[model samples]
Target: MTDATLSRADPIHYQDATTLAALIRKKEVSSREVVQAHLDRIAAVNPKINAVVTLMAEDALRAADAADKAVAQGAVLGPLHGVPFSIKDALDTAGVPTQRGSKLFAGRIPTADATAVARFKAAGGIALMKSNLPEFSAWTETDNLVTGRTNNPWNLDRTPGGSSGGESAAIAAGMSPIGIGSDVAISVRGPAAFTGIAALKATQGRVPFTGHYPAVTKRWWHVGAMARSVGDVALGYSILKGPDGIDGYAVHPREADAGADHIPGRLRIGWVAEAAFGPVDPEIAAAVASAAARLADLGHDVEPVDLPFLGNPLGALMTLVFGEIVPTIKALAAGREGDLHAIGAGIVATPDPTFAAYLEAEAQGEALRSAFAGFFERYDVLLTPVNPMTATPHGAQELVVDGKTVPWTHVMAATSPFNLTGLPALSVPYAFSSEHLPIGIQLVGKWLDEATLLRLGAMLDRKGGLDERRPAL
Candidate 1:
């Protein structure tokens, strides 16, 4: 890499994928140059956070050269032509190792690219690296026997938020501008929020789950696009949203809502900061409430409302996800228990969840879904903090927030409900904690209404509060 490219002063390292693609298309920056710049970035930073586990350096460079030739020859190019993107390790990449954070599958390779990955490549985005995740993509921190641990770039001692932690860390650190992450509970949005970036988990089935592991999470599972801007995320989602005909979860086609952000009048924004997600940090709560106030000041009607069904949204989600996943994963790990991650092994060894418990959880989930649907009837969107606190320490058992020791998944309180209800939710970076950590707010919209969530997210994006901050590392 050239000295110019290696310098942190090179703004290309921090530019969004859309901007990078535009730059390449305009011939101001060659595709090879863009890819190499990111390679240099990863080489310099990956050692610190271990965000990217597998680097496709040679293939990415070759692809970038072909992209440049296509551009030079005046060939029609896709929207993301020549842009570099990171893939979460759980997703399959043909000819690439996709260990999914387990030693049992250490040398495993895929015969085909995951649907989302193929769609990204078809759109001219190069998959430059595979980001790490917890074993089986099941935890709140990114660490496993395969890739060690992925630390938060902001503070090396803190976590980057998980399952999608490595993806978010890479994006936040500018190793890659956009990536894909799966969220069954709080994986994608929580990590995005924790890392101070933009991310959206569209309604269940909006994106396919065909090429990823832990297929059992399919009931409420979704693979979402994580990017630096709401539009970039919307753009990623636009390309990957249609049914791939493989993942049964991907049934409905998203409607064209290109104009979702062009609001003709003030929006009705309902917000809840305390009751549903208990005892949130004052700073976190203040950040979200302030965002609501900002929108209200901009002519929208922002009010505090209580949705009773959210009383135990996380509890309901846990019951449903664990109930369904325990059996499926247990069966998959039948003979390979010793090689699995500790959490995975423990899950498999645990007693099977009862059918009655599954039924009851499903019933509670339906009621919550119906209640959220009614809540949306009275509001255009709902707003709240993405987590009760900022990122926690690696392997943290609990969090001391507001003078109380809370479970690490307190971050899921605001995000998991949307996963359970299959409603669209977007996480936008709005503020920084006193320690200079990122704090994000969640914008929840009606079912399959990612367009509206993006609309609200765009409004927040314009503020660019988090853009001014970057990891010191």
Candidate 2:
């Protein structure tokens, strides 16, 4: 759906949040119509993808009625006045079940919303439902004891990359316009790349993490926005940004660039074809190199630059995540350890984290952060592949790359570095494989500099927003 025709009937199913809001404000469509369109889309597509697990139909419809009334009364509206949105199950939503894809919290509900969700509600967005994620949001596949597994809309035989896999699939399937997602390693970017959409991992603390499940484990985790366009990402970011006062890291308020729509300068972009973390598929590498060439065509300075400390980010990430997470699992599990997911159970089963080991990982992480910050001194942005290859088959830990098997952790290599460094990164769709799966290039910017990433992302998005073809559900 193009921006020019957003008010049309059938294609409103694929429009972005900003356009939907405009349609609502102009009375081209009522909020109830917009919300019901998405709910109907969910009913049609969700069974195949299993992305949206729990439906808040009655509550969402009630909210949509209120939004429509506000529009009719000419009440001042927030940017997202009446658009439909989804929340990841990992985030707390008031009166909404946040099962976290595990039996341990099967009927869990939060009395208060996560800061992100609260802000979305305040913006006049309708919360339609909760999307699926990995149990405790721990691994890279959206399967647990609860919602089963979420498959890629592009190919049901393949997995939709997780831990925000369900959100990506739901968005790709046109079930929701924008949703909240968290990333510790590659959760947001990997799934966005695999599903052919947009997702942001802003600098550490750029978006508050308060009220998110696994609330505070490892400093690398972040909560950010996912949508069909970079403009929508910026819109969501504008509404969700700033310190919630509770998360020590989210210390700043909204920025001037939150309203800025264009790239300010010809950015000097650093491009890395491959890093030390893993081998890349020839197709994926070619796609990223093409993106760099495209930027050069646009008259930007695009050149290759070596990155610092790309070795074994999975090792560093796991070291820090388990070190921080194991203690919490032990405390929460008590005698019900068996109820936890295998990944969670294993963390509890491991020997207690040593202070010396945690200290060592912290030191390494700090150095990595400094290295990325220093690299940004030479270039305004860095570009790399969001993943080495396309989505893998369900339950397959090893990917058959170039006729050789590689560990599943390779999917996260390019993206995990930004998590450690706290630099902002965004996944933008670029190309497709011979088999018709999606490929994406990532743009990394300086700390708290999400504006530049969104700007470049908008440029890339204009070429193709969702895809040349939508998923045939």
Give the per-residue lDDT of model 2 (tens digit) for 1-473: 43534644447678888888988998988889988889899989898999988898998899999999999999999988888899999999988888988788899988999999999999989898899998899889898878888999999998888999999999888999999999999998999989988899988888899999796573789998998777888888888888888999888666734324334567889888655434788888777778888888888999977765555566777788887787887887888878877766766788865888777777877888777767877788888889888888888878876666888877888898788777789998777888888888899988778888888888886353235588878
* Residues 105-222, model 1: lDDT tens digits: 7989999999999999999999999999998898888999988999999999999999899999999998997898889888998899888888888878888898988787787778
What are the lDDT figures for the candidates, one per model?
A: 0.85, 0.83
Residue 147 lDDT (model 2): 83
- Tell me how far the alpha carbon of residue 225 in candidate 1 is from the true structure, in angstroms, after superposition: 0.8
Candidate 1 off by > 4 Å: 1-10, 256-263, 462-464
For all predicted structures, in order, the TM-scores are: 0.95, 0.95
List the lowest-lDDT window of 10 residues for candidate 1: 1-10
- For every candidate in turn, the CA RMSD to the true structure comes to 3.1, 2.3
Check candidate 2 and list the clashing pairs: none
**Best candidate according to lDDT:** 1
